[model samples]
Target: MSKRYIITGAPGTGKSSLLLQLQKEGIHCFSELSRKVIQHQQKLKGNKTPWGDILGFAELIYQKTIEELKSPVNEISFVDRGLADMTAYLTSQSYFIPGYLQHFPYKKYYKNTVFLLPPWKEIYVNDPQRPQTFKEAMQIHEHLIKTYKNLSFNIETLPKTTLTKRKEIILSLI
Candidate 1:
């Protein structure tokens, strides 16, 4: 069976940094779509709502991920943020979760384990697009954990540790 892992956390929790490290280690890891989209939007439209851009970009990423997952690959796949993570973000913002998401059998597509990165204040940085405060990141982190638990997923909350240790923990879970 193809194992699909989700590495998720609030903004500034080193989700992207850790995933980039894993990719360097030759692990099959998907990049964070939100950062890319934010960069694109910043270049295209001076300034815009970060949340709105993230929502649209996340949808595109999900489509691309599903397509990629369709083809067989030797190594286990790790998505920086999964579809459920997007739903949780939108839901927390009081946005209606898209109906199509309910149709996708996510459990069938990915492994049951979800690795959640805890909010790390030391690494939190607010750029032009990602202007979230540390408090907000913590709130989002808690919401993500609750959302995944509500969905009955086996979640492992990872601590703020060295990149190598994080990778080792994730590998053990998969």
Candidate 2:
């Protein structure tokens, strides 16, 4: 079975940038689904969005993640985020996490080691897709750490550094 490594963190933490570089290096990578969902909702003027309906947005992301997991992979792959991220987001927003997600066996699909990119204030920025402030991002970061730890996955925080270095670190670790 191919090992599916997960690279996760709060918004604007350079997860996408690192993943892009990794993909350029010929590594199999699954991009984050939330941003895509947001863009699609915006284009369609739909209600499934974080700002409009968070619960609905969570369910959408959950479904997208499930579909992504079903894709065939012959080599070790990296996922931009994992199911626990949805739990973390819901928890941060004070919403009740769904029991289906709460009971899901995340370890059965993802690797035990999850690379958590810490919030970088210097590099963090708000855009059309990512509107979270740096402070909110930090709070979400804490929730992500707690959620993943509670799920019994080894949390590895990627240092705040250049994309090349971060890529090197992940490649070295995995």
Candidate 3:
């Protein structure tokens, strides 16, 4: 059986860092769709940014996420984020969840093993793509936890610690 894991949490919570550490150990991994969409939109100077065409951005992320999930998993493939993130982002934006995403079968494609790294103000930074304040990230974090739980995912919150411990915890699950 394919074992897929998701590392999701607030922005700048080291999801990518944890995934990178696992990748270095020769594990299969998938990039986060939000970051990928952000970089792509920024390069084109498009309006599909977090502050701009958010609906469009969410749609793109949904599409990309499905495609990534469809890829045949060999051993362990860690997805930096999952479809539940779309709902959290939309909720944070005060927008109603769209019908398309509301009906998406997230549990079907995703594994029950989900690691949510809570907000870490010490490591938080706002860059071109990550413009949310630390406080906003924390708020987002709560929504994410709620989203994953509502979906019946088994959430394992990653404590603020070293990457080695994070990887070890996730590997132990497998």
Write the residue-wise lDDT of candidate 1 on 96-157 in tens digits. Answer: 76766656677876778889999888888998767888898887888799778877789998
Count clashes in each candidate, considering only residues at least 3 apart in sequence or on different chains: 0, 0, 0
lDDT of 3 by residue, 1-174 (tens): 575788999999999999999999999988888888999999998878777898999889877876777789876788888888889988987999998788887767778879999999898999989999998899899999888888888999878999999899888877
Candidate topping lDDT: 2
The window of 10 residues in a row where model 2 has the poorest summed lDDT is 67-76
Clashing residue pairs for model 2: none
lDDT tens string, model 2, 119-156? 98889889988888898998899999999999999998
Error of 3 at 111 (Å): 0.7
The TM-score obtained by model 1 is 0.85
lDDT of 2 at 27: 89
Pairs that collide in candidate 3 are none
Model 1 residue runs over 4 Å out of place are 46-50, 53-65
Query: Which runs of model 2 end up more than 4 angstroms from their true locations?
Result: none
Pairwise TM-score winner, candidates 1 and 3: 3
